[model samples]
Structure formats: structure tokens, C-alpha cells
Target: MRQERAIRTRQTILEAAAELFDEFGYEGASTTDIITRCGLTRGALYHHFPSKESIAVALVDAQSEALKAPERDLGLQSLIDLTFEYARRLQADPILRAGVRLTVEQTSFRSPGSRPYRAAEDAVYRQLQLAAQKGELLPGLDIEETTEFIVGAFTGVQLVSHVYSKRRDLLERVSAMWRLVLPGLAVPGLLLRLRVTPP
Candidate 1:
């Protein structure tokens, strides 16, 4: 019973921190602010997370997991579908939007030794490598570079959409990214052939 209560308290703290961090950003947010918003004491917050950086790491891990969930099938279409769904969810959820903004826009808060981001990067690289091995991606494409390019492009698009564009047109921005990126990364001649098909 005591263990269960502790688990619940930890989850509550994480949830509250995620919300506040999303609203105020990492540098703009503090431990006291998180505890105040959670209605928990500093001791409780410290019990779960030792520092603000730890909470940020936890949030990054959670968000990475959320983004990766739909790609479990490991097919080419699955990859594309997962990316699309992840983008859609990020655009729809304010908390996720905030997290994405922090990740792409606020470079100062990004920790170089962040375990969560490294793990997420490795997982994504493995996925891309597997896809390339299966001939889903273009032959001779550099897996690591390709993965970095895709992630970087997608992140840039999300940042632009979140910061500059109206919210209602987020989907259009996502589609435009797919139109531009998919052609270049996909197997040679495939996109051109697809474009040539009779409507």
C-alpha cells in the first residue's frame, strides 16, 4: 500500500511538471514553481526527481516514447504513417506542442548528455537502418545521415508551424513536408512514377 501510494505521488508530480514545463518552458520553470503547481512540497518533488534537469529528462523520455509507439510494425508505410500520426498528435495536443517547441526552439535548455535524447536517437537510427536493409528506403542511402536529415527536417517544420503559422493550417504544413521529403528519400524513380500515374 505504501509503495502504491508512492508510485501515485510520483506520477502526479511528473504530470504536474509536464504541464507546467510545457506552459513556461525549461529555463522559465523552476522546482518551486512545479511543486507549487502540483500542490506538493519540495520534499515530495525531490523524492521523485532530484532536480529540474531530471524532470526535463523524464519528460523527454516520455515524449520520445509517445512518438515511437506507432512505429512498432517496422514497415515502410508504417514508418510514414507513424510520422504522420505523431505529427498530428503533436499539433493537436498543447502539451506535446510545448514539448516539441522546447526541443527544437530552445537550444539553451537542451542538455548535451541527456540520456533520453540519446536513447531516442539510437532507437530512431536502428529503425531507419532496419528499413534500409529491407529495401524500403533508397539503396546506398547513408542510414545515419538520412535519419538525422529526416528528424531535423521534421523538427524544423514543427517549430515553424508552432511559432509562425496559424494553428488551423498545421496539417497543411505537415503535408508539405511529406511532399518535399518523401520524394528525395524514397527509392529513385518511384516518386516520379507515382506522380505520372493517371488520376
Candidate 2:
């Protein structure tokens, strides 16, 4: 049970750090402050995370890990489901929200070449390629361009919504995003088969 307790303690630290990072950007949230927030001693915090940058890296890893779509057949719906699920999680999960913030807003804690963003793009690209193979993508659609667009549009929508209303309308904005983009991405019959409003 010692191992179990250690795991729980580590998770608590990460969660507390995420909350603080969400409230104040990465540079704003200090390791000393995080230890106090988690109600743990400095030694305990150091045992789990040697430095504040490691915590940020952990959050970025968590962000990429949380973005996968639920298991489903390879098709346009899979792509839609992946995006909608990520949107929903971003709305509800503070950890993920904070992770994205750290990835985007951190200046001092510069990671190597925006790994989190690349991971996000890769996840979407893999699914899009599968959809193409399954005959769900529009004929002559450039898979690379489509993948880039999916990641960019989603990121832009979330950033804009966060600025305007702190993401209170994220789901609605994502739904509207799909409505506008889906027509160009799929055939009419395929569009009819997809659910633009969240899966």
C-alpha cells in the first residue's frame, strides 16, 4: 500500500500544481507555492518532482495523453468524436486546461520546440489519415493540410473563447466550429452521417 499512497500523493501534487498554473501562468506558480497548495512538505514535493519544470513537463505529457478519442471505427465520425471529446474535457478538466495554458503561455519554462502542440497535431493527423483510408474523407482532400487545419482551428477557437468568456461557451463554440468546417471536409452524405454537435 505504500506504493499506492505514493501514487496518490504524486497525483495530488500534480493536481494542485495544475490548479495554480490555471489561475496564474507557469512563471506565476512557484514550486514553494505548489508545495503549500498541496499541503505537503518541500521534501515530499521534491521526491515526486525534482523541479518545477518537471511538473510542467508532466502536465504537457498528461495533456497529450488525455486527447485521444474513444475507440471507434475509422471514419469521419472518429475525427469528429476525437475533437468533440477533447473540447468537452477542456471545458470540464482543470488539469488539462492548465496544461494547455502552461504549454501556450509559459515563457521561462520553455520546452523543446513546442512538444505538446506537435503531439496534439500528431494525434489529429493519425485519426484523419485513418479516416482517409476508410473512405470517409472528401476526395482529393490533402491529408496533411486537413490535419494542420483541424489542430489550428480547434486551438484558435479555444483561445478566443478563453479570452472572451473564460471558456464558458467552449462546447457551443466547438459545435459551431464543426458546422462551419464539416461541409468543406466531407461529402453531403457523409455530413448527414456525422453528428456535429458532440458525440
Best by TM-score: 2
Q: What TM-scores do the predictions have?
A: 0.75, 0.94
| Candidate 1 TM-score versus the reference | 0.75
- Cα RMSD to native, each candidate? 4.5, 1.4
Native-referenced Cα lDDT, model 2: 0.84
Model 2 residue 47 CA deviation (Å) reads 0.4
| Model 2: per-residue Cα lDDT over 1-199, one tens digit each | 9999999999999999999998988889999899989999999999999999899888878987776766676467777787778888888887898888877773888754668778888888888778878777789999888888888899999999999988888888988988999888776678777787876
Candidate 2 displacement at residue 10 in angstroms: 0.7
lDDT tens per residue, model 1, 1-199: 9999999888777777777776777778788888888899899899888988787766666666555634443344445555666667776664555555455445566653445346545655777776677666776778778767766776677667767863555666666776777666668644543221111
> Candidate 1 has which clashing residue pairs, if any?
none
Candidate 2 runs further than 4 Å off: none
Candidate 1's displacement at residue 135, Å, is: 2.6
